[model samples]
Target: MAEDSGAEKTEQPTPKKLQDAAEKGQIARSKDLGTAFVLIGSAAALLVFGKMLAMAVLTIGQRMLRLDEKDIFETNSMFTAWGDAGGELIMPLIGIFSLILIAAFLGNTLLGGFNLSWQAAGPKASKMDPLKGLKRMFGLQALVELGKSFLKVAVVVGVAFFLLKLFFMDIMALSLMSEPNNIESALYFLGWLFLGLCASTSLIAIVDAPYQKWNHVRQLKMSLQEIKDEHKNSEGSPEIKARIRRTQMQMSMKRMMQQVPTADVIVTNPTHYAVALKYDQGKFRAPVVVAKGVDDIAMHIRKIANGHKIPVIESPALARSIYYTTKLDHPIPEQLFAAVAQVLAYVFQLRLYRKGKGSRPKNLAKELPIPDEFKH
Candidate 1:
């Protein structure tokens, strides 16, 4: 089992493994996916409400730049007016952010479903380990992440620069245009550039979400021995199961011993196997094995039968057939009926002779007429 600890994780995770992992907040979600969603969602929210926000900003700018010397010189008036300007902007900003927050939640849920991970939120001492933190943040793996961050930044920035360069003539024309026309042209180009950046960033999420899911599964993959151990845990541990089996067998043997006294006869291999049987003409149509065993147990059954004055007959083949094939308290198998009947009739003859009601019958059958199918 210890060796199996090093075994390859060659098996797919079982459903129980996935469920357990999910419960602990170990779900696959791409950071890029959420980032892209928030960016794109924020851009859309802005486009829809840009005019309202622009009006608030323009109002604040007008108040700040008013040509009234009295307003500029009055500190209390200036502060009060600025505060009112801020209030106008804050509400629209909050609305935009609330929309972005909803978008982020939806994106995360779409990727991995909802998982409230108490464990992820709970404080952990390992997080404070400077050595571990340093290794994670600035180690070899960190370089890979840092390189990716640089690449992402460069790609978005490069595309935006290229778009700006492509519209160089429009940018230059802005200087000669009216102020309102200049602002509109600038906004039109900037909006398209930002949307393009978000679209490109989203491509990263397309690959990352699936990769995260596959990696999460790889981390949870199980080895053969791990599967066995899990099965054992689900059913029961080996030692407890073995002890339970022994306890059950002991109880069964005790019950069988109790039934020995009720048996009319016990057939034996004489030394190795024993099968005690009982039959009542009105109670049962066929003989039932009341108790049975082999080796030491067989000898024990024989001793009990002897103590109860139950007859014991040595019939190795018949004893084996009944012991192996018949369940306690169940009728001997039908194929074994003739063999058992011969033993019972012989037992009955002995009883009659013992009671002094008749003379001894002929010698018992040399062997029970065992059917080939019933042979051990």
Candidate 2:
């Protein structure tokens, strides 16, 4: 009915749906977050490694200026000098780039928790469809992205202009200072500029990260019919499950009936309950219930016992006690040992009497020693 009515996708996406989307590389991602991390990380790396980088640069300058007249005349000497300068600068450069790379990777993964899918990488025919392409270009999500882009650009440009204006006097003062003083002052201004850029990017990242996550969830929302369909697919339809349970019960009943023939006697509540018991002094310490059931199953057990000429004793208290307290193929409770002993002794005596090996046994007691606890 929900499908016929074209139900709205009001329910949250199920775990399975979320997993499937992630497998297809459809996960929340904010480019602004990554940009923020890269910018912030670049500024930090420069701050930490600034002295080392400055020393390397100074070494390179010193090496070039200290060139002897003989070294200037020789191409091999000049090549060696260049190589030494490059080697001096390599370590600090590697450190800065590595930090930036780590920051970019972390920023991308922090929200979506890192998913890689070859299915997403593979080419699809839908991607080439012009009509779908136009729809995507003008989609609500596309408009949202465009708006974020404009906001980010505006923020970054505005901050850059503000920072430049605030540092105008300092920047002018640097030109008056000589040599290394001007260099240090210039680096200080650059640091503040990097900080401003990082702050602006962070502002966009803060807003975009949560919006991306919310948008991803909205895209994956499930309709009521979809949730029901998924449940049926995963757990099997109710009709099929009921059939499976019925089949299992039938098989179990068949097995129970087979054990009825092996029982020494069938004890019954006359109509409602039945329990078949067997005892062998050499094989068991106590009599065990071979099979048991209630109502229709009780009638079925009695029929099978009659077909096999097994003794059927109408002992309501004993039948109910054994049926309720004992499991199939397990001994009756120790508290009911005296009650069961009486029944077993009578069956043995009756069997001998029917074979003409012994005289007829007297009538068994009507009220057996059923313990209070065992009374059902």
TM-score of each: 0.59, 0.83
Q: What is the lDDT of residue 150 in candidate 1?
A: 81
Pairs in clash, predicted candidate 2:
none
Off by over 4 Å in 2: 1-5, 68-87, 116-119, 173-184, 280-285, 348-363
Per-model root-mean-square deviation over C-alphas: 8.3, 3.5
lDDT tens digits, residues 1-376, model 1? 8777799999999888888888778888888889889888877767665666766776787777775777768779867887989898997798889889998998888877999888878888998999999889988657856776887798788877887788888878878987455555666666566667777778777877887788888889999888888889889998999999999988987888899999999989989999889999999989998888889999999899889899999888888888888888899878888878888888899899999998897777877789888888
Cα displacement (angstroms), candidate 1, residue 9, comes to 11
Best candidate per lDDT, number? 2
What is each predicted model's overall lDDT from 0 to 1? Answer: 0.83, 0.90
